[model samples]
Target chain A: MAAVNFDKVVKSFGAFTAVHGLDLAIDEGEFVSLLGPSGCGKTTTLRMLAGLEFPTSGEISIGDRVVNDLAPGERDIAMVFQSYALYPHMTVAQNIAYPLKKRGVPKSERGAMVQKTAELLQLTELLSRKPRQLSGGQQQRVALGRALVRDPKVFLLDEPLSNLDAKLRGYMRVELVELHRRLGRTMVYVTHDQLEAMTMSDRIAVMEGGRLQQFAPPTEVYRAPANRFVAGFIGTPAMNLIDGEIRQSGGTWQFHAPGLTLDCPPLLDSARPGPACLGIRPEGVVFGSGPIEGVVQVVEQTGHENIVVARIGADMRLTGRVGAERVWQAGETVRCGIDIDRAHIFAAGAAGERLNRPGLRPVEAPAVIKAAR
Target chain B: MIRRVAFNLFAWGIVLAVAFPLFWMLVTSVKPQFELFRRPPTFLPETWTLEHYIRLIQDTPFLTYFKNSIILSTATTLVVVAISTLGAYSLVRFKYRGRESLAFLVLFTYLLPSVVLIIPLYLMLVSMGLSNTIFSLVIAYTTFALPYALWLLRSFMAGIPEDLESAALVDGASRMGAFVDVILPQLLPGIISTALFTFILSWNEYLYALVLVNSDSARPLTTGVMNMLVSSFNIEWSLLMAASVMMSVPLIIVFAFLQSYLTRGFGAGGVKG
Candidate 1:
């Protein structure tokens, strides 16, 4: 098992940059995710690591060796693509044994390995069946099994669960987390889904527009987002972001969003009275309580959970999650307050460049990050 | 439903029309000579005899021509498959300068009419001391078969999703390894059809064989069977029919073996979107 390092690695397709100077040091045996939206260069980054695509600039090293020009086979990494990409013509046994065979392993050892791996993945019964014969989840397992047979130094998976049904995806997610824990191999997973990143990664590298926006522990990144993008990108109902000037009102600060206002938390209150964006997760938006009121415009009941969308101002709408058993109708005005202590404030222009809480010295009282001017 | 039925009938009608000559050849081979010339053209004989079949064995160099055709066609097909699969793989999978130009060149080679080139080829063959030789015939046959094989197999190779091969590469196989292990097995239908196509093209080729081979040693069945009518002067209709029937047997057997793949291989369900 080896740690993979990307030192200012950059990839460009002609004039358009796909991955711009991405620097990451993935620890050995760590489960890390390169999470982003589509076209945000997550797959491109993974491909570069796998040696499928060479970076346009900088170096990529697997462990101690700089293998920027090495072939994919020389990299000792296995990737399971978004599509399972199982060989349609081969049986599950043949597909899983492909890499071992390619490596010129002895026939006896290879067969034994295939059998052992199949049994491990619960694929023994389906060994003779082709990929098309298997369900999507089973095919995905086979794809993983195929990679696992290689016993590569690093495991690279590009949204392997993205194609499965939600229920199956969740089940597979749990299985994967267990597998990662069991194997303890250096694994770099790429996905657009933040839940997958949050639940699976030892560390999450949030990205946008070919740039690494934030790379930190899941809880660290979620609770203390590096930017507004990470703050909005992570949470379920999304973080409610109201950007306006922090006007001094009655010697206390209030975040002003046109007719809307939020009492500043102590951490935010002490920060310079400047233009800021208040970040509150939908769960952090307390409803039926504070000064702000809105008519319920729409209610989406997702079994066991629901989203209550309320029209706060002439055009502004805020969404809050409630239990499916809780009944709330449209056109009824409801009061909602900000969960003040949980509210995060960021400088107006630097809302996308978050303040690092790790560097801030803790205080006996609540502390705020004085972001670089 | 009405349109589908009409289409099926029309398709079967065309198939039957194309197959009539071989069916007629088989029927006439078993009939007496007098019945062959009879009016209304009896497709089946009132009395069948093995007389022609017996005669064909003793008559001419039919066996020699059969052996020649087999050697030339099989060699040509094998060579065509090897060359075309490689050419098609490179043309379909790799990106390089002159890729389009190289593809156009292959198509141009494929489209080069044998009739237009046969005379010049014969002249070159004679100058090179290759006339009336089985080796020259195999070369000519490969020239004719390679282009279509290349073009068809290129499309088939391209139909395999790149993701499958890419995943294999990441799984520790090289690109070529991925192709041989993962992609080539999926191309079974294409390879089978291409082999059959080259074999049939070489087996049935006539103009070049007739033009280049004056000796009976190099003559194939097509030229051999047609010659039986003229060189003997007293036409043995039954023997000629027997020879004609014999000429078709390999094709029939090959088609039978490859018919399923041939149907599937004919451009349907190609790499679904």
Candidate 2:
């Protein structure tokens, strides 16, 4: 295993830029995920590291060696494509043994290595079958076996679980995490699924529009996002953000919108008194009596919890997560309270900088925010 | 039940219509030469004889022509298929300044009629002193066969997913190594079909063989068999029929072996499945 680094890497296709000066460092044996939506350059970043693509500028290094000029095979990296690109022409044994054969492993040694890989993946009984004969999950295992048999310096998986059914995806998610722990290889997984990144990554590098939005631990990304984009994109129900203006009234700051007003959290020392946005997680929007009053719009019941969306005025809607037992009907008037301690404040506009929390990293937090804003 | 039976009858009628000539050729090759002038031609020969086949093999220079045809067709198929397979792969996969235009140019060459090209090709071969040789026919046949094979294989090459090559590259195979290991296997059916086509084209090509070679030693079956009908004082119908039946044997054998792959090759180029 080796540590991987993307030193101010940028990738562009003619007039369009796909990844914009990305600088990420991953430690050896750490499970890092590049997470974003489609066209967000997460896969491009992974491919650059795997040597499938060359960065337009900057350098990519694996284990302290600059690999900008190296081919994928020369980089000693193995990748599992999203399609689980197992060779349809070869049986499971040959598919797993392909890398070893390419590397000039002797025939006898290749047999044992393939046998051991199949055993590790619980594919011993199916080693003689062609790829078409295997089910989706079984083909996935064979793809993994092909990568694992090489014991390469790094393992790059590009949305490997996206093709499986729901239950199989969950199972493979856990299996991947367990496999990462067992092998302790430096694995860079590219995925657009937030749940997979949240559960499996040691540190999640959230990206959008070809730029890295936030790179921190999953809990850190969830609890204190670097910007408004992270705050809106990381959660399932999505954090409720209301555009308003904050002003210093007397000694404290108050946020004022069209029909609702709330005192700013006292912890926000850097909360500039100007136009800003307030972000509240669904769980933080309490449904008890308080200054804010609204009519319930919709309530989505998901077995153990209820997601209640309430309209505060002519336009603004706040969603709150509450226990399933105590539910509010649609069109019912309800008094709602904003959990001030858990609220997030941001400078208002398209690219909002977080006004509440201090920036996490000087390199990632300030320059990108300044440039984008 | 009546509709099904009627459909079956119509299908069988069309099949028989196409197959009757081949059946008559086989039957005529074994019929006695005197049976040809019977008042009403027999559907099944009243007297079967192998004299035509024996005489064609022993008395005529049929074996020499057969060897020449085999060499020419096999050589043309091998050379054309090999080059076109690599050319189509490069056209489909690699990026270069003129790649797309070059592929279009290859199809453009295929669009040109063979009769329009034969004169210039004959002059080029004569100037090179390659006339009256099987090698000359192989080179002349490649003019039409190469472009046809490349065009057919290009679509087949495009049907293979790009991810498979990327997977092979990441699995420690070089670009060319990955092509040989991954792509060649996937392209086998396409190669077989293209080879079969090139072989048949070279085998049945009468105009080029007639113009390029006049010696009995270098003559292919298409022109060589026609020579027997026209050059003789009286046309030997039975011997010519025997030669026609012999000329189709290689094609029949090729079809029998690669019949499944032929359908698959056509299907793969059209739809993904």
Candidate 3:
């Protein structure tokens, strides 16, 4: 296994830039995911690492060897495409043995290696069948088998599980984690799905608009996002970002929006009292009794919880996860409470920097109001 | 139910109308020379005789012309298909300056009538001293066949997903190695269909064959069969029909072998990926 490093890499297509000044270092045998939305540079970064696309400027090294001019085959890397890209004309056995054959492995050894890989992927039974004859999950396994037989220094996967159904996607997600564990190889996974990145990565690199927004462990990325984009992009039902301004009042800070005001935690010395945004996770927005009141607009039932989208004022809307046992109807005025310690404050814009520090998360609330169970 | 029946009947009527001449050619080949001017033409020969077919094979230079046609068509098909397959692959996959205009130019050449090219092609062949040879016809045929074959195969090449080649490249195959292993197999059906078209085109080509070669040794069946009817004053209809039947046998065999791929090739060759 090898450690992969990108040093200030930038990829541009003539006038348009895809990735800009990306510097990421993945440790040996670590599962690092490049996560972002579509048109974000996640796929481009993975392709450059795979040697399918060369970087416009910067150095990429696999285990101390810079591979700037190497062709994909010369890079000693294998990739599993999102479409699986199994050779339609070749059977499962041939598909798995393709890399071995390409590398001039002898006939006898290729058979054994292919058989071993097929067994590892549980594809031995389907070895004689063509790619079109197999189901989507089976094809995915064969694609993985093709990559595994090579036993390259690093495995690059570009949304390999995106093609499968939801249940199969989940199952394959666990299978991929197990595979990575068994092999103990460096793997760089590129995915737009935040759940895939959060659940399987050793470290997640959150990217947007061709720039690295944050690269940290999954929990850290979730608990302390680097910017307002990461705060809004990483979570389900999305983090509620209320645009407001913070002002110093009576030695503490108060955040004010259109029809809402809340006491902020003790600010850091660098904290400026200016235009700032408040970010709270859906779980942090309690639906019982607190300082602010809001009318419920829509309740989305997801079996285990009710996701309530409530209008706090004429403009601000908050989404809160509440118990499914208590049904919430539209136009009902409910008291809302923001978890002050857990809530994040950011400078107010799309690419705003996170203002709240993790060290300041333990401050007590201004009031003793409790949320209903 | 009645409307469906009428539709079926109409479709069968059209099929039969198209197939009538082929049926008549077969029937006419087996009939005796005396039955040629019968008051009403016989749908089936009353006295079936293989005399016309036997005489045409034994007493004429039909075999020589058949051999020439086979050589010309096969050579044209091999050379044109080989060049066009690579050309279409490059046109569809590679990014280069003038790539779009180059593809458009190929179709532009195809749009030009073959008749317009004959005189200039004949002059060039004569100056090169390539006139009256099978190789010359192959070259002449390529002038028309290459563009047509390339245009057909371009769409077929585009229909193949680019990801498959990327997968192969990452799997340690060189670009050409990936092409031989991944692309050739996917393009086999398309190549077969294009070959079939080019072969049929060169085989049935009359104008170039008539103008370029006068020797019986280099004559293809289309013009050679006409020579058999014109060289004689009597104009033996049975002999002409017999030669026509023999000319279609190779195509019929080729169609039988490639029927499944032919339909698929046509359907996919029109749709761009």
Q: Candidate 1 — what's its lDDT?
A: 0.82
For model 2, residues A1-373, the per-residue Cα lDDT tens digits are 3899989999998789999999999999999999988999999999888888889999999998999999988898899988888887889999999999989999989998999999999999999998878888899999999999978889999999888888898899899999999999999999988888988999999999999999999878887888888999888788899999889978978888898788776535667678989898887888967778999999988778888999998999999888889978999999998977677788887558787754332212211110000
As for candidate 3, its interface RMSD to one decimal place is: 4.3
| lDDT per residue as tens, model 3, A1-373 | 3899999999999889999999999999999999999989999999999888899999999998999999899888899999888888788999998999888999999999999998988998999998877888888898899999978999999999887888898899899999999999999999998889988999999999999999999887888888999999988878899998999977888999888788886556788889999999888898989888899999988777788999887788999988899999998999999988788888878989888777555433222111111
lDDT per residue (tens digit) for residues B1-273 in model 2: 999999999999999999999999999999998897687899999998999999999999898889999999999999999999999999999878899898889889888888899899999999999989999999999989998899889988998888888988888899999999999988888899899899999999999998999999899988988886667478788998998898999889888989977776554422111
The candidates' DockQ values read 0.44, 0.50, 0.51
Residue A178, candidate 1: Cα error in Å is 1.3
lDDT, candidate 3, equals 0.88
Candidate 2: residue A205 lDDT (0-100): 97
Off by over 4 Å in 3: A249-251, A266-273, A362-373, B261-273
Q: Write the per-residue lDDT of candidate 1 for residues A1-373, one digit (tens) a residue.
A: 3999999999998779999999999999999999988999999999999888999999999999999999888888888988778888778999899888888898889989999899889999999997777888899999999988767899999999888888888899899999899888999999988888888899999988899989999877877788888887877667787777676767777778877877765543336777788787666666778888899999877666667888888877788766677678999889987766677776677334442233243322212211111
> TM-score, chain A, per candidate?
0.89, 0.94, 0.95
Candidate 3 chain A weakest lDDT stretch, 10 residues: A364-373
lDDT of 3 by residue, B1-273 (tens): 999999999999999999999999899899898887898877788999999989998999999999999999999999999999999999998888899999888889888988898999999999999999999999999989998899888988888888888999988899899999988888887899799899999999999999999998889999998987766457778899999999999999888989877676455321111
Best by lDDT: 3
Error of 3 at B162 (Å): 0.9
Q: By DockQ thresholds, what CAPRI class is model 2?
A: medium
